[model samples]
Target chain A: MKMTPKAVVIGSLLVLAAVVFVAVILPYADTNQTVPSEIFRSRVSEEAAGRLIYIQNGCVYCHSQSIRKVDWGLGADRIAQAGDYVEDHPILLGSARTGPDLSQAGGEHPDDWHIAHFINPRYTRPVSIMPAFEFLGMDRVATLTSYVQSLGLKAADRRMERQRFWKQEAIKAYEAGPEANVRWLNENVPQGWRDVPNPYPTTEAGLARGHVIYQNFCLGCHGPVGDGMGPAQPWIYPPPLNFTILKGREVSGGVLYYQIMNGITGTAMPYFKRELESQKIWEVGDYVAVYFINQSDANSEPRGIDAAWEP
Target chain B: MSNPSPTYQTAKGFCLTSAFWMIVGTLMGLIGATELVAPDLTKNIGWLVFGRVRPIHINIVLFGFVTPGLLAAAFYYFPRLLKTELYSERLGVVTVVAWNIALVAVVLTLMLGYTQGREYAELIWPIDVAVIVVFLMVFFNFIMTVKQRTEPVLYVSVWYALAAVILTACTYALGNIVWRPSSGALVGIPDAIILWFYGHNVFGLLLTPLSAGVTYYVIPRSVRAPLYSHTLSLLGFWSLIVVYTHIGTHHLLQVPVPTWLKVIAIVDSVAMVIPVMAFLINIWYTAKGRLGEIHADIGAKFVFTGTIMYFFVSIQGSMMSLPDVQRVTHFNNWVVAHAHIGVLGFAGMIALGGLYYILPKVTGRPLYSRLLADIQYWLVLIVSIGFTVVLTIAGLIQGNGWLNGETVYRILPQIHPYYVTRASLGLILVIGAALGFYNIVRTLFVRSGEAVT
Candidate 1:
C-alpha cells in the first residue's frame, strides 16, 4: 500500500459501500419481511398525523416508546418486540426517559386529561418538571393526545375502552349528586381496605412531608385544598374527588392509600405506586384524612405496621 | 525551502471562523443543559426550547467548531507536505465564506423549526444542498492541489484529508435523502437504518479521519521526530474505514432492524479495537519519552490528551454495543456521556489542537497568550471529564431506577442534582470556548510585534 490519494479515496468509498449494503440497503430491502406483532396495526390517519406532531415537538427526547424485559419491574405489562415498531418511521424508541415510558400510555388518561396535562403538566402533576405544550394549541393538543393514546396500538385500544366504560359510570354518579358520587366512589374500595385505618400517627413533620408530596404528585388534579378543583378539573371528567364530601363518609386512610396506589381503573386517577414510595403514599393519605375529611383514624386500632421512628 | 512571505490566508480564515463558532456552539449546549435542570426556564420560548436548541448545538459543534478547525489544519499541511502552494487560495477562501454562510443558515433554519427531523440529518433539503456544495468545493480544492504537487508519494495526512471531504459529501447526500426533498426519508425501519448509517459515519468517517490526519502530522513535528510506524498508521487508517462503517447498526441493537445486521454491527463494533489500538500504539510509541516536549507545546498537549480520550471512548463504545450491556445503558444518559467523550473529549480536543499547532506557522507569530491557551485547555479537560462523571452517574441511577420499576417521575428528584451539576460544568466549557476564541482571534489579527522561535 503506497498510500496514494486515488487509492485512499477508492478504498474509503468501497468500505462505505460495503457498510451501506450490509447495514442499510440489506435491511431496507427486507423491510417488507417485518411482520406486524400481535399488538401492531397500521396507524389511523389522525394518529399518524399526531405522530408527526410528536416528532416535531421532539417529545421523544423525554419519553421512550419501547419497553424491555428490564422494564418488567417498572410496571411494564409487556416487553417490546421489533414487529411492534414495523409501522413506525424512525421508530421512536427514544433515548431518554425524562418522563415516563409511553409505550402503554394509550388510555392511561382520557382525552380531557391529556388536554389539561399538555396545556401544563403542573395542572395534573404539581411536581412534574415536564415542559408545557400549551403553545401547541388546543387542536394540536388533541392531535398529540390521539398519538399518545395510540402508543400501545391494539393493547392501548383495549385499555382506552376500559377507560371509556368507567368514564360513563363515573359521570353518571357525579351528575346524580355529591353524596351519590362519594358513595359510588367508596363502594369500589374493598371492605378490607374500607375498614382499615391509617397505621401511622399524624405529626407536623409528617404533614409537611405529605404537603410536599401532594404538591409534586397529586395537587394538580386534587387541588391545593383537596377539593378536586385543580386546574385540570376543567378537563378531567368526574372531575377529581372533592375530598370534603368524604368527611362524614366511611373513607378510611387505607381506602385512600389503596385508591392512590392502585389507581382507579377507567378513570383519570392514575396509580402513584410507581411514582411515590409506600411511606409517601401513607403520609399523603393521612394528610387527606386529617385536612379535607376532618377526621383522623391515623391512631386507630389494628395498626398494620409500626414506624421505626415512632415515639 | 521556506518562502520569505508565505501566507496561509484560507487556513487562517477557517481557524478564526472555527474558534468563533466554538463559543456559539458551546453556549447553545450550556443553555440546553440549564433547561434540563429547569425545563420551565425557557417556557414559551420556541426558539430556545430544548428540542430546537439541541439540534443547533449539535449542528454548530459538528460543522462550525470541529470540522472547520480540522479543515484549517488540513489546508495548511496539505500544501506544505506536497511541496506546492494551494492550487487556489482564492477558492479556498471562497469555500470558507460559503461554509460560514451555510452554518448560519443551518442555525436559523433549525431554530425556526424548518428541519428534516432526523438526528444528525436534521438539515433541510436546501441546507443539505449547501452542505454538500461546500464539501464538494473543499474536495475539489484539495484534489486539485494534490494534482499540482511536486511530490510523488502521498503522505498519510494527505490521504486522510482527501478521504474525509469526498466521503462526507456522499454520506451527507445519502443520509439526508436529498433525492426526496419532501420528507427527506424512506418510510419505516428502512429510514432509521439509512439515517444511523449516515449518523455514526459522520463521526467515524469524517471527524475520526480528519483528527487522525492532524495528529499524524502535528505530534511528530512538535517532538521533532518521525512517526513510530508508518505501516501501523496505514493499517489503522484502512482498518478504521472498514470496521467503523459497519458499526452504525450497534445503535439499533434493541430495535427490529435484522438479526444479521445487528450481529454485524456488534461484531464490527468490538473489532474496532484493532484499528483503535493500532492508532494508539503508533501515536503513543511516537510520543514515547516526549511527554515534556508535548506538554511544553499546548497544541501537542491537547492532541495527546485527545488520543487518551479516544482509547477510553472507543473501548466504551464497543462494550455498549453488546445486547446485555445495552439493556442497562441504551436509551439513557450513558449513551449521552459516551457521545460527549467521543465528540467533545476526543474530536473537539484534536480540532482545537490542530488549530493551535498551526497558529504560529499560519500567522508567522507566536500565540497571543500561551497562558490563556493553557487555561482554556485545563478548563475544557476538566469540564468534559466532569460531564462524563455526572452524566454516567445519572444514567446508572435512571437505568437502575427503571429496572426496579420506579416511575420516571420518581427518578426526576433523584437525578435533578446531577442535571444541575452538569449545567454548572457546561458553564465552564462555555468559558473555555470563549477564551479559546479570544486567543485565536488575537493571535491571528492582533500583532504583539514579537519574534518567534
Candidate 2:
C-alpha cells in the first residue's frame, strides 16, 4: 500500500465521518425520541436559575443524578429514566459518586437544613468531603438549594408538600414551649415503639460508641452538650431539639430510638434508618438517656431473657 | 538558505510551553487531591474549590502538558521526514501563543465558576472555539509542510500525526457542540450521549494518536531500525479511528441510554484490542533485540516504558467496558485509576519522552541534566503506578460497599487512607513537574551550566 498523504488524510477523515454517523448521529436520533417520564415537568424560572448555578460550580463532578437498579439497597426510591431530563440543556448525569446519588434528593431535607449544608456540609454530615458554598452568598446558595430541592421533579414536589405541611405543625409545637414540644414528639411515636425499652444495657463501651456516633451524626445540629446550639443552629429552625428539655418528661428509650432512626421529617432532623443500623440506634438511645436527660429505663422492667452477646 | 538558520522556533516554543504548564497542571491535580484528603484545606476559597480545581487539572494536562509535548516532537519530526522546513514557523508560533493564552483563560474562567459543566467538555463556548481553531491551525501547518516535501512517501508517523490533528479538529468541534454557544450541549439523554462521545474522543483522537506517532518515531529511530512491519502500522492507524471512536458509548453504558448504543460500545470496546495490539507489536518488535540501544537514550527509554503502560491501560479499559465489570467499575475511583494509567502512565510518559527527545535536537545542545530527566521519569512512573494501586483499592472498597448497601457516607473512613496516599503521591508528582520546568527552561535559555533551581 502506497502511503500517500491524500490516502492517509482522506481515508482517515472518511472513516471518522462514517463512525460519527453510525455511533453519534444514529444514537442522537434514537435517544432524542424519548417521551417524558411520569414525574417529569419543565423547570420553573427559579429551578432554571439554580440549575445554571449547579453547572457553574461543577457540582456534577462529585454528585451524580443517575440512579440504577443496584442503588435500591442504598435507599434509592426511583430509577433514572431518559425522559426525566427532557428539559435539561446538558443533562448532568455525573461520572463519579464522590458523594451520594441525588436523583431524588429534592425534599430529602427542609430548606433550612440545605442552607446549613451549603454553608458547610460538615454542619450536617460530619465526614462529608463536600466543599462549602458559603462564598456563593445567601442568595446564590438559596438559588442552588432550590435546584437541589427540585431533583426528583413532581415526586420531589409531593415530598416538599408533605414537608411544608409538617413544618407548620412542628413550628407550632416548638413555639408552644419545651413541655408541649416533648409531649407532641413523644405521642407521634407508634404505641409499640413507645413502650419498647432500650433493650441494650448502658456500658462504658456502649457509651463510647454512642459518643462517637453522636459527634459524627448529631453534634452538628444538637451541639456537643445536647443544647441544640450548634453552628448550624442559626439556619435550622425549630432548632435541633434541645435535648436538655426532655428530662422529667417520661421520654422513654423507645422515643429516643424512634426519633433518631426515623427523624422528625418536618424540622431539620433527617432519618438515619438508611445510615445507622438497629443496634447502633439502641446504643445511641441509651447514651442520650443516661447523659443528656440524666435518666434511663435501659435493662429495667419487662426485662426478657438477655441476648447471647449482651455483656 | 539565509533564513536565520531555521531555529525550529515552533518546536522550541512548544517545548517550553509544555514544560511550564506541566507544573501548573500537576499543581492543580495536587490541590484537588489535597481537598479530597482534607476538604476544609481550602475552605470557602471559591477559586480553589475542588470542583473548579479538578477541571483545571484535567484540561491543562490534556491541552497544556501532554498535547504540547507531543506536538513539540511532531514539529521536529515533520520537517525531517518531509525533507523540508515547516510551512510557516510564524503561524506555528502564533498558535503556541494563542494556546497559552487560552489555557490561562481556561484557568480564570473555570475558577470564576463560568463553565458548561460536562466532564471533558467543561470549557466555556469561547474556549471550545479556541481549542478547535488552534487544532486546525496546527493541521494547516503540518499538512502544508507535507505538501512541499521533497520526500514523496509519507511515513506511518506522518499519517498518525496528520490524521490525529485533522480528526481531532473535527471531533472537537462536533463533541463540544460549538454550534450551540450558550449551553454547548443538546437536551437530556442526547446531551449525555454526545458529551461522553466527545469526552472519549478527547483521548482517542487527540492524546492516543499523538502518543502513537511519537512512539513510532522515537522507538525505531533510537534503535536505528526500520519499522518491523508497515502493514501493522497501517492496520493500527485505521483500526484506531474506527474502533476507538465507537467505544465512547462505553462510558454511557450504565446510564439510561438506548440498549443498542450500550451494546455497540461494549462490543467495540472489546474490539479495541486489535488496534492496540497492532501498534504495540510493531513498536515492541522493532525494539525487541535493541533494548540496550533504547536504554542508552533517556528519551527512547521513556517512550518504550509508555508503550508498556499503554498495553496495560488498554487491556484494563477493555475489561472494564464489560457490562458485568462496569457494574463494579462505573462511578467510582476504579475509573479514576484507569484514567491515571492512561493519561499519566501511557500518554503523559510518551509526551515527556518526546519532549526529552526533541529538546536537544531543537535547541542544538545537550539537555541541562539527564539525571533530572531520569528523576522526573521515576517520579511520574511512581505516581502512575502508585495512583493506580491506591485509587483502585479505594474504588473496590467503594464499589463493594455500595453494592453491599452501605451508603456513600458510611464508607468515607474506609477510603480516607487511600486519598491521603494519593495526595502524598501527588506531591511527589508536583515536585517532578517543577524539576522538569527548571531543566527545560535552563536547557532552552541558559546555554551553559547544570540546572540549578
Candidate 3:
C-alpha cells in the first residue's frame, strides 16, 4: 500500500465509522432495549438535581455506583444490572473507590447523620481523608444527602422504611428520660449478648488503640467525652449513646460489640462492621466500659479468644 | 534574501507556548496530588479544589502541552517535507495565537466552574467551539500546504498530522454534543458510551498518531539513516486507526454497557498489540545499530525512551482489558498509574523529544544548556517510574483490600505513605516541566548560534 493522502483519510474514516458503529451507534440504538431491573426506578426531581450536585462536586471520583459479582466478598447486597442505570445521564459508574461503594448507601444512616458527616467527615470519622463538603452550604448538603440516600432505588426505599420506623421509637424513648432511653437501647440487645463478658483483658496499649478507634469511628456523635454530645449531636436526633448511662448497668462486651457491629436502627449510629475489624470493635467497647462507664468486665473468666500478643 | 519572512516563526511560537503550559499543567497536577494526601490542604477554595484542578491539569496537559509541542514539530516539518513554504506564515501564526487564547479560556472557565462536568469533555460549549475553530484553522493551513506540495508522494508523517487535526475536530464536536449546546451530553447510558469513545480516541487518534509521526520523522534523521521499512510504518498506521478506535468501551466493561460492545472492546484491545509491535519493531530496527549515534543526539534519546514506554504501556493496556485482571485493577490507582505511563511517559516524552529535535533547525542555535535538558529528562524518567511504582502498589493494596471486604477508610492508612510519595514525586515532575520550559525558551530566543539558510 503506497502512502497516499486519499488512502489515509479513507482508512481513518472507515475505522472511525466502524468504532462509531460498534461502540456508540449500536449501543445507543439498543439503549431502549434495556428493561428496568426490580430495584431500578426513575429518580425524583430532587434526587436528579442532587445527582447534578454530586457530579459537580466530583463525588464520583471517590465513590463507585456499580457493584459487580466480584464484589460479593465485599458484602455487596446486589450485583448492579444495566437496567439500574437506565435513567442516569452520563451514568456515574465511577472509576475509583476512594470511598465505599455508594450503590446501596440509601438508609445507611439517618439524613441527620449524613448532614453532619458532609459538613466535615472528620467530625463523623476522625480518620477520614474525604474532603469536607461544608462549603456546599446546608441546603446543597441536604440535596446531596437525598441523592446519596436514594442510591439503591427501590431497594433503598425499603431500608429507609426500617430506619424511619426505628427513628420514631428512638425519639420517643429519648424524650422520656435518660433512664428510659438506656433501658430501651439495652432491650434491643439479645439476652445472649447482654450476658457475654469481654474476652480481651484491658491494657494501656489496648485502651490507647481503643481510644484512637473511638475517635475515628464514634467520637462524632458519641462525643469526645462519650456523652453523646459531639459536634454531630446538633443534627442527629435520639442523639448518640452516652456511655455514662451504662455505668452500674448490666452492659457487657457482647452488647457493645453487637450494637457497634450492626449499628442502631432509626438512630444516627452507623454499622462499624464495614469500617472496623473484630479486634478494633472489642477494643473500643472495652475503652468505653473502662473510661466513661467507670466499669470493667474485660478481665472476666472465659475470655473469648486468647490474645496471641499477651504473654 | 530578506530573512525568508520568518518561515518557522509559527513553529517557534507553538514550541514556546507548549513549554510554558507544561509548567503550569504539571504544577496543577502537583497541587491536585497534594490535596489527595491532605484533603483539607485547599479547603473552601472552589477554584483550587481537587475536582476543578483535576480537569485543569488534564485539559492543559492534553491541549496546551502535548498537542502544541507535537504541532510545533508538525508545523516545521509540513513545509520542509512537502518541499514548499508553509501555505501562509501569517495564517499559521494566527492559528497559534488562537490556540493559546483558547487554552487561556479553558483554564479560566474551568476554574470558574463553568464546566459541563463530563470527564475529558468538561469545557463549556463556547470553549468547545473555540477548540473546533482552532483545529479547523490548522487543518486549512496544512491541507493547503499539502495541496501546493512540490513533492508528489506524501510521507507518513504528513498523513498522521493531517489526520490528527481533522479527525479530532470532528471527534471533539461530536463528543461534546455541540448540537445541544446546553448539557453537552446525551440523556443516559448512551452518553457514557459516546463520551468514552471520544475520550479514549483523544489519545488513540490524536496523541498516539502525532507522537508516532514525530518518532517516524526524528529517528531516521537523527541516526542519519534511511527508514527500515516504510511499508511496515504505513501498516502500523492503518492498523492503529482500525484497532484503537474500538477499545474505548474497555473502560466500561464492569458497567452495564452492552455485552457485544464489551467483547469488541476486549478483542480490539488485544489486537492493539499488532500495530503497537509493528511501530516498535520498525523503529527499533531503524535504530538497531545506531544507538550510539542516537545517544549523541539528545532528541533521539527521549524519542527512543518514549518508544520503549509505549511498548510497556500497550502491553499493560491489553492485559488490563481482561475481566479477571480488571476486577482487581479497575476503579483504583492502578489505572491512574497506567494513565501516567501512557500520557507522560509515552506521549509527553515524545512531544518533548519532537520539540528538542526541531529546536535547532528552527532557531539555528544549539540548546542553551544541554545539561539542563539532560537533567530534565532524567527527572521526568525517574519521577514517572516512581509514580508507576507507588501508585501501582497503592492500587493493589486498595483493590485487594476491597476484595477482602475491608473498608475504604481502613485502606487509607495503608496507602497514606504512598500518597505522600506520589506527591513528592509530583514535585520532581513539576520541576522538570519548569526546566524544560526554561531550556526551550533560552534555546529559541536567547542563545545565538550559526544561522541556517
Note the clash tally of each candidate.
Answer: 3, 0, 0
lDDT of 1 by residue, B200-238 (tens): 999988999999999998899899888999899889988
**Which digits, one per residue and each the tens of the lDDT, describe model 3 over residues B224-277?**
888898888887988888889889899889887888889999999999999999
Model 1 CAPRI quality: medium
Give the Cα error of residue A82 in candidate 2, in Å.
0.9
> For residues B142-182, could you state the per-residue lDDT of candidate 2 as single tens digits?
99999999998898889989998999998888888999999
Q: State the iRMSD of every prediction, in order shown.
A: 2.1, 1.2, 2.0
- What tens-digit string does per-residue lDDT give for candidate 1 at A209-288? 98888878888888889998988998887788888878777888888999999897666788877678788999999988
DockQ for every model comes to: 0.56, 0.79, 0.59
- Model 2 chain A: weakest 10-residue lDDT segment is A68-77
Ranking 1 against 2 by lDDT, winner = 2
Chain B TM-score of predicted candidate 1 relative to the true chain B:
0.98
Inter-residue clash pairs, candidate 1: A73-B405, A74-B405, A127-A216
The ten-residue window of minimal lDDT in model 1 chain B covers: B444-453
Give per-residue CA lDDT, model 2, range A1-311, as digits (tens). Answer: 88898898999899998998988899889988899999999878898899999888889999998998788433287888888889888889999999999889999899999999999999988888999989999999999999988999999998899899999999999999988888899889998888888888889999999988888788888888888987899899889887888888978888889998888888999999988899888888788888988888887766778678767
Q: What is the overall TM-score of model 3 with all chains considered together?
A: 0.95
Q: Of the candidates numbered 1 and 2, which has the greater DockQ value?
A: 2
Q: Which candidate number would show the highest TM-score if scored against the true structure?
A: 2
